[model samples]
Target: MNRENVLVIGGAAGIGKQIVLDFAGRGKKVAVADINKKALDQLINESGRPNDIFSFEVDVSNWESVQNMMTKVKETLNSIDIFVYSAGITKQVSFLNIDWASWKKTIAVNLHGLFFSTKAVLPLMKNKNGGSIIIIGSGSAITGSGGGIHYAASKGGAFGFMRSLVGELGKEGININVIAPRVIESDMLDRLYPSEGSKNTLKKEIPIGRLGKPSDISNLTNFLSNEESAYIHGQIIIADGGRTFRPKSG
Candidate 1:
């Protein structure tokens, strides 16, 4: 098996870190990119077998920075086989209370960042005859949710971006897909909600009986980034433990 070179944006922590580690453990060369230099170093140090892990500090929200980071990753690792846009942010602001600045920031990170990161890597992937672009969306992207209208809108845009990119790039052998996860246990979750009881209650309401761990999403990402999913394109796979399908009886 030819080991794939994977570049995971926002891989310093959370689900993105898990994806980077998983790919590295499989003997693939992994580039962990993020704006958090300390966290990036922490992931590299924690990996133990550090040879497979490389760190690049890049803010995905900045188009030029992301482009430069992609160039460095390709130069250092030869060629990238997979690109994962696992970088995102969400806030629990009421629609009426969310100021334009806050909403714009959410859009920049959650939607625009995905666009910049994926666009930067597409050319490199096209040269290889194809590669996988995985965007981490959210359950809110599909359903109406309170207090996170901006977040939901950004994710909805991600779905649109993935499908459109797939249509235009599939002929070039590139596969684009979005994996929308339900509530997941990660630093982002901790920061966004910050209430343990609330988080726990939300987790229990899910049909899966627990919040998704970073590994759950990472496992799905691994599959989508591999040869097995070559024929799969432009699909939004919801890995929310059937939460989206449960009857709203309450």
Candidate 2:
């Protein structure tokens, strides 16, 4: 069996890191791209520096950087069988306080990054005749928050973008989908909820009564990236531990 090649953007930590680890454990050749060189190095080290796992530093908000990173991925892996766009940024600033620069940066990393990364990998997948592209979105896109307007907008755009791409790429044997996870126990979550008690308090509102884990997202991603999920495309799978379904009064 030929080993599958995977490219994961924003793969240095959190859900992205889990996805990379999962793929590597499955004997797949994995290339991780991220803006944080230190995080990338830590990921490589934590993974025991496997020969099948490679890392690259990239700023997904920049098209030229994305192109350069993709070129490196192609050179290292030869071809990409799975592409995962997990690069994103968010701030807790209120809508009224959002500056033009902050808004643009959020959109650039969350929305434009998705577009750039996907565009960069399409040809490689098309050439292979079949591939999977999974975008890591946020449940906040569906249920908007007052402080994260820019984040919500960017993620909402991701949904629309992937849905539109379905018509364009599905026929070419390339599958695209978005996975939106909420309140996952990651560094991002830590930033959002500084106090440990605050994290626990938020969990009470969730139907599952626990914060989502990186494995929760990574397991679903693994399934979606394989042949088993061939029939699933242009869909948004929300992995929020039933948080979205809970009633306000519950």
**Per-model lDDT:** 0.85, 0.90
Q: Cα RMSDs of all predictions? A: 1.7, 1.5
TM-score of each: 0.94, 0.96
lDDT of 2: 0.90
Tens digits of lDDT, candidate 1, 120-222: 8877777786788888888788885523899899999998888777778888877888999887888778877689898887776788688789999999998
User: Residue 206's C-alpha lDDT in candidate 2?
Assistant: 89
TM-score of 1: 0.94
lDDT by residue (tens digit), candidate 2, 1-250: 2329999999999999999999999988999999999999989999985697899999999999999999988899888989999998888888889999999999999999988998898877877868899999999999995248999999999999999999888888888999999999888888878898988888898898888989999999999999888899999999988888877863
Stretches off by above 4 angstroms in model 2 are: 1-3, 248-250
Runs in model 1 lying further than 4 Å from the true structure:
1-3
Q: Give model 2's TM-score versus the native structure.
A: 0.96
